[model samples]
Target: MTMLRTMGADRFNYNVFKKKMSKEPLYPTQECSYKMRIEMLDSYLTNQKTVDVSSYFKPGHLVIVDLRDPSTNASLVIALFKIIVGLFVKQRMETGKVLLLDKAHKYLNSDPCSARFTVSMTSLIRQQQHFGIRTIIPTQEPAVVPDAILDLVFFLVLHCFNFPTWMRNLRRHISVNQDRGESEGG
Candidate 1:
């Protein structure tokens, strides 16, 4: 529907299209595109019921939604995490909420998902003090992680990092140049 203008298609003309297709046949590309969309919808949406995603989230316990599928879309994974984060922020808890994006470079990079997640996370990070939330994201490529996040970060943890090459690269990154000079000596 959003692409109707770009597609040069008239809106509210499904019946017109149907009548035309009845006389003619769909072109090869159109046939393949429709078939692929049907298959994709069936694969993801079949047998799925509308349910609360946050019911599994508890106050004092950590719940991990692990996606082991190699072919899963990064946007889908981030979208699920966004829902989880929103739910977590609303829950009353004794312990402070900590969000860990474990090896998040795989799913949070300079892709279509990156821009939207960056905006959402930037807002969340800016309000972390009020919300008592801490976000820890470990990525080998800090470039993949949005600059807004890196700017708001107060602590940077580098574990077992002994490569001068990486250290040199990190020096150019946000805050590593100031106090981590001895790290590359190892």
Candidate 2:
């Protein structure tokens, strides 16, 4: 049995050696290419669960927040924001650079004030900025965010605004116009 196994191994090795020596490539050959066809399986599979937000924020990493849609459950959103802010604060304490927050106003809305999560998240944003951590907030509705928070933004990206009030407020920080001539004039 050992001798037979040795012979089989030797034969396999010789076949591989001969194939390498041949002009044809080892993979995707004319004779064996049909066997390499990948079939798409028609089977039901469970949807992938959403990732925990905590794992996303590393020390000294820049983050972009897109909270365009209002949250169904405000409490969960607030709790998540608190955890992120805490992580950023800890990271900043250890390292001088801060974790930046982008598009913060959507999650930190001020109107109605019924959403405890939005209020808490807004407070956290303010606190993080107070500790000398940089935060950049981009929003279409600047009025929804507090003036104190808006004042801290070092950089501003003003896209074309449809509302006059938004246009007026944006003009104070950055230039906004329909045409090149108007932009230069403003």
Candidate 3:
């Protein structure tokens, strides 16, 4: 038997694999697994300088971006998220489900480097819905979030909030919905 190994091959070599394991059948007879695809992109992007992870979402697969790592730069993650959202818009891939935005207020601050592409969460929420992408934004206070976004979100799940201002602001946008629930945190 002859074996051929190529280091860091970009494209797939089905023939080589077939020759090596002639008795074994391919696992994915229909479509490639979504988890495998996410893993592949995660490995590929972590090594690149400027990661454009938007391409992965073109298929509308469920993806979770963990930004809780202290070493990870929040801004870069936000920029990457913007790229994904932009791709979602460009490709018209709308799943019509809440995207579940965490720490969205971080994008409110000004950052000159990503200014051009740093879109508002409000706009993203509005635009995403057109393509059937709903968003769940958890904010400490309505002050941190713009009135526009507050107005745009179809549902609001309120939790224990301290300040009266947050309640005041929320009242303007709050509408009666059975989906609304409480959270342990604001």
**lDDT scores in order:** 0.62, 0.47, 0.53
At residue 9, candidate 2 shows an lDDT of 30
- TM value for model 1: 0.61
In candidate 3, position 71 carries an lDDT of 39
Residue 10 lDDT (model 1): 22
Q: Which pairs in model 3 have colliding backbones?
A: 96-132
* Candidate 1 per-residue lDDT over residues 1-186, each given as its tens digit: 222222222222223433354465668886775566546545644444532344555767787767445544566566656655776666667768888878766765566666777788889989987888888888777656766676677888777676666565555545543654565372
lDDT tens digits, residue span 1-186, model 2 = 122233333322323322343544445563353222111111211122432333455565656543333423443444445555654554434444454445555556544532554555446556765665655556667766655455555577657655666655655655445464433433
* Clash count, one per candidate: 0, 0, 1
lDDT of 3: 0.53
Candidates' RMSD to native: 8.8, 20.3, 13.8
RMSD of 2: 20.3
TM-score per model over all chains? 0.61, 0.44, 0.52
- Which regions of candidate 3 are displaced past 4 Å? 1-61, 68-75, 91-97, 110-119, 175-186
Q: Give candidate 2 misplaced runs (Cα > 4 Å).
A: 1-72, 92-103, 111-132, 170-186
Q: Which of the predicted structures, 2 or 3, would earn the higher TM-score when compared with the native? A: 3
Worst 10 residues of 3 by lDDT: 1-10
Error of 1 at 120 (Å): 1.5
